[model samples]
Target chain A: MTFFINSVYFGMVLTFVAYEIGLFCKKKIRLAIVNPVVIASLIVGAVLVLGKIDYETYSESVQYITYFLTPATVCLAIPLYRQIHLLKKYPLAIMGGVFSGVLTAMVSIYFIALIFGLTHEQYITLLPKSITTAIGMGISEKMGGIVTLTVVAISVTGITGTLSAEFMLKLFRIKNPVAKGLAIGTCSHALGTTKAMEMGEVEGAMSSLAIVLTGILTVIGVSIFANFIG
Target chain B: MKYLKQLAIVLIVSLLAELMAYLIPLPVAASVYGLVLMLIGLITHIIPLRLVEDVGDFLVENMGIMFVPPTVGIIACVDELKQMWIPLLVAGIFTTFLIMIITGLVTQALIKKTGGES
Candidate 1:
């Protein structure tokens, strides 16, 4: 029993099972709010709690999955590389869009977090919330924020972006695929890219480009500008 | 064999990037180093895109799944979230739109100014 419980496969199987369940629901419900990660985390969290399995034990067994995160993030370079033509064609537009996204995210998060009276750790955790979890978690760690909070915040931001994407696009009267995709990807990261893909091929590609660029910009911004926020 | 080879190529690149990030004093994320280096290699033809395309596509396609496990870390922060749910939700919802609107507007304005399309 001990061997089975501690075996890496134990946690791996649990996560896969939980994710499949989440996928099933996502297909049936067709709702962005029913995000696979959110659902999987809830089920996995419940299992660990009910089974009296500690967080440390669960995380330890699932170390392999976490390790893949670094490579998966690196793989994002593939999309950026593929979209290099767009970069050359409208370099200023793309960079300008991403810059605005990063600046707005940081300034808004800073003020909102302060207005809500968040602690320094909470503020820092949320500082990188607009970027993907992989990069956001790194920024959170470097800035002395709670990694867990940052991850959760990023997930919430992604879900919000996915759910409200259409409304926001219509509200903004954004017609350009480049603009639309960049906005979605910058605000919500990969999940928003999924939505952008649904809109059209060009939107998908632009969003893919936006995700990488926004990740880079946000990392630079948080590392340098975080000191000014407090 | 094909998949393994592709995966190995990406793994090596990632490992090298991680090593370089460690040696460098910059505060950038190691994964960003891996990404930038990989991009440079691909553009310069040092690493052909096809070599890692299969495994890279596979990983990017399933990236969401990989993120699930780390999110379980949220369980550890449940109490903190409970205490701050309102502000957290407001911050998330408000700022998400703020970024979206600002980015979209900026991109559109730039495109119009550059004479691409109105």
Candidate 2:
């Protein structure tokens, strides 16, 4: 029992268990707000605190899990491949929306951080908060931002995106499936894509395309913005 | 055995991407490098779609589960995060809506102008 508790199995098991609980809650509530990542992290986090488990120990035990993040990101290409025809269909419209969305996400975060009196470090940390984990982590690290802070910010950003996107769509009267998918995926990454998937297959595929395009655009946007700022 | 082969293909592509990122002076993420490389390979038929379809689908479909552990890292900096909770929450919530509305509206208009489906 002690051996199982100390091994990588411990963290992996804990994560899976917590995630299952999250899924259960989502099914019960039928609310997008009940995001599995949020629920799992909160449950697992509280458990770690209550049990006196250090973050370092927990992360170390789950280190292999983190390694999968890279390959998982690579797998994102498959969806984009399957839906490449979408790119061919509406190249200009897709690029216009994705580029604009990526810029708005970062720029708004920067201005908001400034208006709210956040330090430059905090601003940088929040820069890539809307992108997927793999690309977001890479952008944050490359731009001298804190990975932990970016991860947390991304989670919050994702949760917010997931929960409020539908309302925003109605409020803005966005009726186009392509536009809806592009907006959600561009603004909130994969988490928003889940909601988009619920909307329809075309929405889901378009959102998947936006997720990859937004990531690529955001990386370039951050690099160019960094140069300008420096 | 099939799963292992698929995993190997992904890892190898990721490895090559890592090498590319190292050799290049740009700060592009290795994952992006890998993604682009895999994308080109697929488009060119150099890498068959079936080769990694199962593994790829499984990974992307369950990608959110992978983010949980890293996000739990926030526990270590709760105090520091607490100091800026208002700004953090406000910024996160506000920007999400802002981006969604703006992106959605702009795309909607453009698509309308282009004479596309709703």
Among these predicted structures, which one has the highest TM-score?
2
Instruction: Summarize candidate 1's per-residue lDDT along A125-190 as a digit string, tens digits.
Output: 788888877678778887898877777788788878877988889877998888898899999987
Expressed as tens digits, the lDDT of each residue in B16-77 for candidate 1 is 98898789865456777788788899999999999999999788767766767766776777
Worst 10 residues of 1 chain A by lDDT: A193-202
Candidate 1 segments whose C-alpha is farther than 4 A from its true place? A1-4, A119-121, A194-201, A227-229
Report the lDDT tens digits of candidate 2 across residue range A122-230: 7677778778776777788878877777777777777788778777888889998888888888888877776776677667667777777887788788776654332
Off by over 4 Å in 2: A1-4, A141-144, A197-201, A223-230, B116-118
**Interface RMSD of the predictions, in order shown?**
2.6, 2.6
Best by DockQ: 1
Docking class of 1: medium
